[model samples]
Target chain A: AQSVTQPDARVTVSEGASLQLRCKYSYSGTPYLFWYVQYPRQGLQLLLKYYSGDPVVQGVNGFEAEFIKSNSSFHLRKASVHWSDSAVYFCAVSAYGNEKITFGAGTKLTIKP
Target chain B: GGIITQTPKFLIGQEGQKLTLKCQQNFNHDTMYWYRQDSGKGLRLIYYSITENDLQKGDLSEGYDASREKKSSFSLTVTSAQKNEMAVFLCASSIGRGTSQNTLYFGAGTRLSVL
Candidate 1:
């Protein structure tokens, strides 16, 4: 079965500091990766996605993710964080030609001033 | 841009009662899904529909029932609300299922509380 894992349950960082959220996936075939962010009491919004080609993919709000096939990981990173960036993040994966996606237990991020 | 809407932003239901949640999407997408979100647990798929009148059971569909009578609307019902049950139910849709173009758009979820 395909699964996604996000090791950290919560992360606290200072404003303007760099941020990195880890994600690991388990799948036999080539996988489609995605990162989503959710604000309090709001629906989730897509941050980035990786299907194929270059490992590095840029997303909205200065966020980016790199897919490492060998390590089965797609980690999200931001050079500088803002207080508004504090939210819950989720990593998801789906197999080629499959519409079903598996999501990781989200990581709650807190940006301290 | 299209939007997805879910009715009853917050629901308070009695135990053993049947509760229904409605979702509507103007994206004209062919696939729609229902998921339950719980604290400490990621979203769990309850049901999905590939087209109007098509229903597919997901991993956590035992106590739930779903209807997709129209292309733009999908509804989920809790067969029997459990006491102390508290969770958010999310509705999502995508263009279609294929190699590409499967990005899902979600609606603000409905928070359910069972008393």
Candidate 2:
């Protein structure tokens, strides 16, 4: 079974500060990785996804994630974050041909003024 | 652009009572999914349907039942509500089952509270 691990349960950052959310995965073969964000009382929205191609994939809101196969990590990063970016982030993994996606225990992000 | 709608934004049920949550999608997607979200734990899939009349069990399908009578609708039922149980039920749909087109579009969610 493929699984995702997000070490940080909560992350606090100041507005306009650079941010990074680390994600690690355990899968036997090639894995499909994704990052999702959920606002309070709202369903999740996809931040980005990595299947194949270049290690780095760009997503909405100036967010990006790099898939490092050797380290089995796909970390999400942003040069500068805004207060609106504060939300719970989840990392997920799925097999190549499977439709079931396993999500990590989400990390809550807070933006300090 | 398409939208997924989940009915009964909030539901309160008594212990041992049966409750059903409804979902409708206008995207005409071929796949629909039901997931349960708890406070600390992330989303856990309860059931999914590839097409109308097709059902598949997910990791957390034991206490739940799902039906996909139409391509645009999927419904979930809790056989018996547990006392003091609270969680958010999410409905989602995708274009197809393949890896590339599996980006799921989700509904706002149905919050369930059992007394």
Tens digits of per-residue lDDT for model 1, B1-115: 9999999899999999999999999999998999899988878889988889999887789999999999999999999999999999999998875653378899999999999
What TM-score would every model get versus the actual structure?
Answer: 0.96, 0.95
Off by over 4 Å in 2: none
lDDT of each: 0.92, 0.91
Fnat for each model? 0.42, 0.51
TM-score for candidate 2, residues paired by index: 0.95
- In model 2, what lDDT does residue A111 have? 97
For candidate 2, lDDT tens digit of each residue in A1-113?
77888999999999999999999999999998899999876779899998889999999999999999999999999999999999999998877667777788889999999
Q: Can you write out model 1's per-residue Cα lDDT over A1-113, one digit (the tens) per residue?
A: 78899999899999999999999999999999999999987789889999989999999999999999899999999999999998999999887776777788899999999
